[model samples]
Target: MRQEKKSEKQEEKNKECLADLHTTDPRDDKERIKQTKGGLLEDSSNWILKHDDFRRWRNNDEARLL
Candidate 1:
């Protein structure tokens, strides 16, 4: 029940995000970037590369993606 509500809320939010995609203004993007200045997310790919599963995959010769 709780999960359903969360899923519905997320679906609504996704719709809202797409609703603006077709009509985004450059000024809005500039302002959004300015608002997030100095707080933008940094790369986290290193964390994934260091995980044990990733290490195993990197070392394995027969672990094809398919």
Candidate 2:
């Protein structure tokens, strides 16, 4: 009976962990561009890019590069 109780507690903990793992907050590209100087293309093979935000960021520190 004690072992069954412990197993049930472990199952509850696992369910909570799985819920946390699957949860994510939606974020958009514009917000990301403003927050981060650089952006990435969706295609895996696509090249890294620098946008207007990157230019602004680079302007602040010339040493920063894409």
Candidate 3:
């Protein structure tokens, strides 16, 4: 029916909108570092200071092991 076709089109449009919402453009590595590592530093300066590459370190797993 015509109503069924219109509903299908609306559903496709809604899916396209949701797909665009889900994709994130790649962010600058430094900015991600600043946000996450800086937050950690702000929270606990002494803990992060022990690591030489604290600014660039991504995973806290190694730090946790230490």
Candidate 4:
């Protein structure tokens, strides 16, 4: 779908732009994504997990994603 292709292109662009970025902290990536991409599609939250679970994964790297 077009959305998938756009996401892939944006991801590739971000990778190239940030290849020189070196930091264990994920704050930079999160900030960069917030700037470059639209916040979230309407109703997209329902496509994945519940809001609380999503928040957990967003904050905790050790959390399992399914």
Which of candidates 1 and 2 is the stronger one according to lDDT?
Answer: 1
Candidate 3 lDDT, tens digit per residue, 1-66?
Answer: 999999999999999999988855466655787787773344455767667688446455666665
Error of 2 at 48 (Å): 18
Worst 10 contiguous positions by lDDT, candidate 1: 37-46
Instruction: Give the alpha carbon lDDT tens digit for every residue of 1-66 in model 2.
Output: 999999999999999999988845456646667579666556754323456665676577665654
Error of 2 at 4 (Å): 0.1
TM-scores vs. true structure, each candidate: 0.34, 0.40, 0.37, 0.30
The numbered model that scores best in TM-score is 2
Candidates 2 and 4: which is better by TM-score? 2
lDDT of each: 0.83, 0.71, 0.73, 0.76
Q: Measured by C-alpha RMSD in angstroms, how accurate is candidate 3? A: 8.9
Model 2 spans > 4 angstroms off: 25-53, 56-66
After superposition of all CA atoms, the RMSD between model 4 and the true structure is 15.5
Q: Tell me how many clashing residue pairs each candidate has.
A: 0, 0, 0, 0
TM-score of decoy 3: 0.37
lDDT of 4 by residue, 1-66 (tens): 999999999999999879867555678777777788955457866756667767777789666454
